[model samples]
Target: MGHLSTHVLDTTAGRPAAGVAIELRRLGADGSSEPVASTVTNADGRTDGPLLEGASLQAGTYELLFHVGAYFARTGAGPEQPFLDVVPVRFGVTDPAARYHVPLVVTPWSYSTYRGS
Candidate 1:
């Protein structure tokens, strides 16, 4: 079976970004996006459940919205104006039978992500 997952790490803190808000969206063919699920990161910076799995997994574009601003604030990263607010990482799932682990490494001003096991 296929599955979708994510993890967020606060580069500034050098640890998992716990309690951050996350939204999973499936992009429609007409260019509109629909919400797949919404959950917050656990202590390990991962969702408590698979965002998508099995029959729910499809071949298309997906978007992950990470509310990093609130996370930064909660972690005591108080900047006058956060350079990076919400981070959106969009990627495609070409194979429904593959496990997509989109991990995020983020700071107040920057973020990066890639396909993982």
Candidate 2:
């Protein structure tokens, strides 16, 4: 019954980071990374479906890669030299029966994330 989800908010613009590209990757047993799913943020800056569905949810280390640089550039929020290029948030899933919500609040110069409901 484990589930994974995420949301992104552009704090500088006071709105959701719409159209942002996100990649969900799982850490393989061989210490390499594998893509689990890829998605784009909706107008609400959230995935329309569960990031990890069905048997994909497991107890392990995973990464959420946020393409902040491209988002900023497309939105014209920052110049060519953006503060954050690719933001990678890594965390552990200790329980396969639990639901994980990783929410990211980001700006041109900074970003933060936390476990959400």
Highest TM-score, which number? 1
* Candidate 2 per-residue C-alpha lDDT over 78-117 given as tens digits, one digit per residue, 9 for 90 to 100: 7689889889999998887889999889988999999997
Give the local distance difference test score of model 2: 0.91
Regions of candidate 1 where Cα sits further than 4 Å from its true position? none
Cα deviation in Å at residue 116, candidate 2? 0.5
Over 4 Å off, model 2: none
lDDT of 1 by residue, 11-116 (tens): 8888999999999999988999999999999999988988999989999999999999888987788486777888999999999999999999999988899888
Q: What is the lDDT of residue 100 in candidate 2?
A: 93
Error of 1 at 108 (Å): 0.3
lDDT (C-alpha) at residue 38 in model 2: 92
How far is 5's C-alpha from truth in model 1 (Å)? 0.3
**Model 2 reaches what TM-score against the true structure?**
0.95
Candidate 1: RMSD over Cα atoms? 0.9
Candidate 1 weakest ten by summed lDDT: 74-83
Superposed Cα deviation of residue 104, candidate 1 (Å): 0.7
Model 1 whole-model lDDT (C-alpha atoms): 0.91
